[model samples]
Target chain A: MEISELKITIVGLGLIGGSFSMALRELKPKKLWAVDINQDVLKMAETQGIIDRGFLKPNIPLKNSDVVIISLYPEQTVNFIKNNLNNFKRGAVITDTTGIKDKILTEINNFIRDDLEFIGGHPMAGKEAMGFEFASAEIFKGANYILTPTDKNKEENIKLIEKIVMGIGCKNLIKISPKKHDEIIAYTSQMPHILALALVNSNHIDGLGLFVGDSFRAITRVANINARLWAELLIKNKDNILGQIKSFEDSLINIKKSVMEMDSDGLRRIFEKGSDMRDILWRL
Target chain B: MEISELKITIVGLGLIGGSFSMALRELKPKKLWAVDINQDVLKMAETQGIIDRGFLKPNIPLKNSDVVIISLYPEQTVNFIKNNLNNFKRGAVITDTTGIKDKILTEINNFIRDDLEFIGGHPMAGKEAMGFEFASAEIFKGANYILTPTDKNKEENIKLIEKIVMGIGCKNLIKISPKKHDEIIAYTSQMPHILALALVNSNHIDGLGLFVGDSFRAITRVANINARLWAELLIKNKDNILGQIKSFEDSLINIKKSVMEMDSDGLRRIFEKGSDMRDILWRL
Candidate 1:
């Protein structure tokens, strides 16, 4: 289907929503309706033309939009979907940018109206900086956009969503199961953030600011984390996240063992592994 | 006190040493001497014409040089001083480019000839790369240049070395005790590498390649650590590094606690602080 035929409504016009709207507009969506609880943010977004038609709040029923994308927190996403299910078009494809999948999948499966199809998507790109001020239409360019669907998801809806994501400049879209998606993210995204956050929190950065090298700051830079949202997401996917955290802890222990024994070789192997792994990952 | 009057000898022709030579040449130093174990690397340096004279493993005594800068690993630094301390001209200011200093300060303090002043320098910059292939003359521009001197250091020599460091592109020179420097670096450089190594090692990217985002890889890019050198450095500064590791653990625990409690507010505070810290630090 063409963009002009798709009436896209994006809830939560924050960083991701605003950027998505800007990027998707390249396809020339006829009406890019945005629903944000904050009228001020949405008004500024309107001024910037991030969205053509916008709603200040969820007070009014959503129009029969072709697609409804929730860019809210994982838990908040479910509640929004529940409240809006009745108002959306009968065959509209629903999707969200929430980081986790298990809780969202279960919630959507439980409360989603039979008439609507929800195919979960995750665009794998972001910056150290957030918000629309730094948001760009190019963030998703050449990045992986995962299309997660279960047996309940219709193939037509999945393929349509995939095509729409591609319109935003994401070059790769891979199909995956929701459970595996959560687990993989637990290892890659969640665990790394946990380690970065822990490293920053534990280090004496506040008092000994001047001594920090660019490398140290660069490495632990992610430590100043978004705690509230992260906490909810981490516990929400506790099994996967906790498992990944344990793997990280185990890795640290191995390093500690080598250090304790004065085993420079062991330590070198670990560093070599990390270096090699990083190189290989980048090879793709 | 112009560069034209100064005679300098750099023992390593890698990134740091090469940058030093290039910077000093701009000063038109009277004589610029270099020694590298790799003669091919020496030939590469000669092409740059920064050196007035070059040696592959200089048999000529480094003692005759007015300023001797040792750019090597922490352990090899002591070895370099050991093999050549007797050959040094009286009152020569000996410096090095080792990241950790506590061990270096203690290891060589008693044995150094009273005539030679060990004024250590640590420039906080490097790529994920190594050696002369990726070396740039301008890497130290606008970067932190640290001067670590003990009380035993002569006042005049300190000024002389400071003048030389500034003569290079390193404008932000900070003076601190070697112990304090090491302790701070424990949190900053040493610990970050260890965390990176652990993260890279744990993820086993070789086996599980496709699930990575640029953010995950970006944060752990440092994990492609120089293991041999890093292991030695970590053990050499074990006491301080271990302390840093502990602090990092403590920080992670707080985040873990926050996550366990599903505390989004706490998570955002960390992100806010991280974001604020990065903004301010990057400007510096």
Candidate 2:
């Protein structure tokens, strides 16, 4: 089906959902509807002309939409899908913007309707701020969108979601297994977040404002994070995050040992290795 | 004593020195000179009209200038001052741009002549890239410049240095004791660099480029560091850095334990502390 002919519904009007609505509006879908718990948010999105209609409940919109993009917290997303499984339109393509995929996919696989296609998606774009007020369409301009498609999804449905991912201005479309997405995200996203939180909490000095440079600012940029959301994320992906943290701890210990022993050569070697790897990663 | 009438000479035309030269050129000093082992850098400065004269050796410029700013590696800065103790013009105000102040000031105190004033200065601004080729006057714009002044430093000389610091576009002039400077830097500057290097080294994944988001990029931006310089920095301030690393390790362990045990409340509390602290710091 052509993108313009599809009726799209975004479930949740927070940062990601609002942003998805704003970005998808540019694609000129036949009808863009949003279902959010907050009536004010729905009213605001409607007033902004980003959505054709707004529903406070999912039942009516879910039954009418051709595409549904769920953008809620991990637990809430699963509950929303489970509670309203019968409400979705027949043969609709459902996708999500949750951080983790393996658990969600596993749970959804057990009870998902055979007619509907559920493609798990994770958009690698966000800001430290939350809510619909802070949302912007440009957030996904240069982002990477990962899609975890199982055998239950048809090729045409996957292609349709890819078209929407591109329509949102994402730079890359990575298709990986649900397990692989969780593992990589544990390293690239969750572990870094934990480290940032730790770094901020480790500060014992006062009036550090005078001494900090760009390095300190950049390293701690994500330290001002969403506590509840991140706590849920960290606990949900516990095993993978723990493994990444252990690897990070080992690396920190090795570097700390070199510093303690005054081993200049060892420190130099480790730093060079890091520098080389960073250069290669960024260049690629 | 006006900035326009002062004869200024900058030694070691690397990133900091080169940038200093460019920024100071706007003040229209009586004569601005630069000295470096790399004749190409000196020639480039001369061609760009950032300096009136370029010296292969510091002897001539040091003897003629009323203000001298030394920008070199920590050890090199000390050695240059010690070797050229007699070369500086009488009553010339000498300053340096080094990361650590206490050790360098202690060494210089043992042999520094009383006729000249040597006020230690550390501009908290830099990039991962090094050398004069990458230097820009804008590097100091809105950056913090720290001045470590002791009883030996005359009030007039300190005031003069403050003018130059502000004239070069630094947002703040922080005057603190050398001991206090090093202690704060370990937590604010050195610790973040170590964390960045460790974060980069911990990445054992082969294709992280596709998976990384803005958080990972920001946290590890300093990973592409100058190894030799950072090694010297981390080792010279060994005790303070070790103390900071230990504190950070404790913080990480606490968060890790919470995640491991699935203690959502514990994780939320820790993350809230970090987030609130960061908000306060950035707001201040």
Candidate 3:
């Protein structure tokens, strides 16, 4: 299909969904359909011309969409697809924007229409603060997007989803199994959030003004978190996060032991190792 | 002493020292004397017009200085003062800029000339990239200047140091006991560095381009650390850092346990608490 003739439907008008809608607008789709449960969000999106049409509930026109992007919270995303699987057009390339993938992919794949396809997608980018108010199309610029497609996924469906992902301005489109994506995310994304939260909660931050510098600000910047969304993400990816925490805790304990023992050489080794590892980013 | 009529001596010529010399230039003292062990650094400062006179070694002219500031690494700061206590002019207010203080303060207070007063000062600001080339007078523009003065310190001497701190554009001058400063710094400064180092060291960061995001970058920005300087600091403030690590690890364990148990409510509570604590910085 020509890019301009594609009918694209984006469900959930939150940050990711709204931003994705704006980005997909650049493709000049024939019909841009937005589905949001919040009436205010739907009204604002429609009034702002963010979509050709907005729905408080799924409607018949959504059934004609050539592509559907579910951008709800992880659990809601699976339930939405399960309930509305038959509403989607036959051979519609369906994808989702959720941080966790294993459960959602499995559940959707279990009951998805055989004619349609469900590809698990995650944009590895987010604002520490949530909601549609802060949404911007630039948020996904140069960000990594992972697509987790199981053996059940059709080749053409995967290709169509990839085209949409590229059209949305994602820098890297990595193809990984859902299980591997979870493990990598647990280490890179989830562990850092846990560390930031723990660092903030462990301190009496009342007098932090007198003591803080750039380092504290940099480390705790993530502490200005979307608490509800993160709590859901953490709970959904419990096992991988737990394992990542264990790996992180072991490293922490080793350094703590060195500091306690006044082993300057040992402590230096750890800092040097960390500096070396972090330098990889600069090299890249 | 009148501000401009006073002769000021600055020892050591690294980042803090170089920046201080440049900042003190605004006072236009009678003679801004610079002493550095490295003759090359002394020559460079004189050529740059950062100082009126350069001294390769402590000289008789240094004895006539009304105010002396020692800016060096923690251990070096203590050693410099111990060796040159007699070199400072009688009744001159002496101060040193070093992160850790209890040891430096006690040693200086133990064997000091009765006429000369020693005050411990820490300008709580720095850049991760170190060197005289990177130093700037603007670094102290809005940074807190902490003065840890013991009972042996004269009130008049503390006031004199405060004037110098203000003249150099420090936004605030806070008086804290040396013991309290170390404890607070362990949580505010040292703990964050430890966490950053741990986070960097804990991961296989080689392929980080594929998994990194803004949050990861924020938390690890401090990972471009001065490894040797930080190693020395971690060792010098060992006891306080250990205590902080223990407190932080307790919070981490609580979080890890909640994630392991899939207790979303408990995890939410922790995130909410952290968000609340972190919000204080924004309010300030």
Give the best candidate by DockQ.
Answer: 2
TM-score of chain B of each: 0.89, 0.96, 0.95
lDDT of 3 by residue, B1-284 (tens): 56788898998888999999999998888889888888888888889999987888776656888888888888887777778877888788888888888877887788888988889999987887777888889999988999999988888878888988998899989998898888888888888888877877777533555776677777887787777778888788888888888889899999988878888888888999999888876456
Q: What RMSD does model 2 have?
A: 2.2
Fnat for every candidate: 0.65, 0.84, 0.76
TM-score of chain A of each: 0.91, 0.97, 0.95
lDDT tens per residue, model 3, A90-138: 7888889988989778888788878888899999877766777878888
The runs of at least 3 residues in candidate 3 whose Cα sits more than 4 Å from the true structure, single-residue gaps closed, are none
Better of 2 and 3 by lDDT: 2
Residue B256, candidate 2: Cα error in Å is: 0.9
lDDT of 3 at B8: 89
Q: Poorest 10 consecutive residues of model 1 chain A by lDDT?
A: A200-209
lDDT of 1 by residue, B1-284 (tens): 56678788998877778777777778787788998888888787778787877886554737568888888888888888887877778888889998888788888886998878898888886677778777776887777788898898988888988888777777688998888887877777777778777776676323245677655765776777667778888888888876777777776767666666767677677656655655565444
DockQ of candidates 1 onward, in order? Answer: 0.54, 0.75, 0.68
Residue-wise C-alpha lDDT for candidate 2, range B66-106, written one tens digit per residue: 99999998889899999999999999999999899999899
lDDT of 1 by residue, A1-284 (tens): 77788888888876788788889877888778889878787788788877886797553425658888888888888888887666777788889987888778988899888878888888887765556676778888888888789999887888788888888999888787788888888877887777766665464544465666666656656655555567677878877766666777788889888887889888888887788877876676
Provide the lDDT at B162 for model 3.
92
Per-residue lDDT over A1-284 for candidate 2, one digit per residue giving the tens place of the 0 to 100 score: 98899999999999999999999999999999999989999999999899999999889889989999999998898888889999999999999998989988999888888888889999999987999999999999988999999988899999999999999999999999898888889987887778888988998987776666677788888888888888888888888899899999999999999999999999999999988877776675
The 0-to-1 C-alpha lDDT of every candidate, in the order given, reads 0.77, 0.90, 0.84
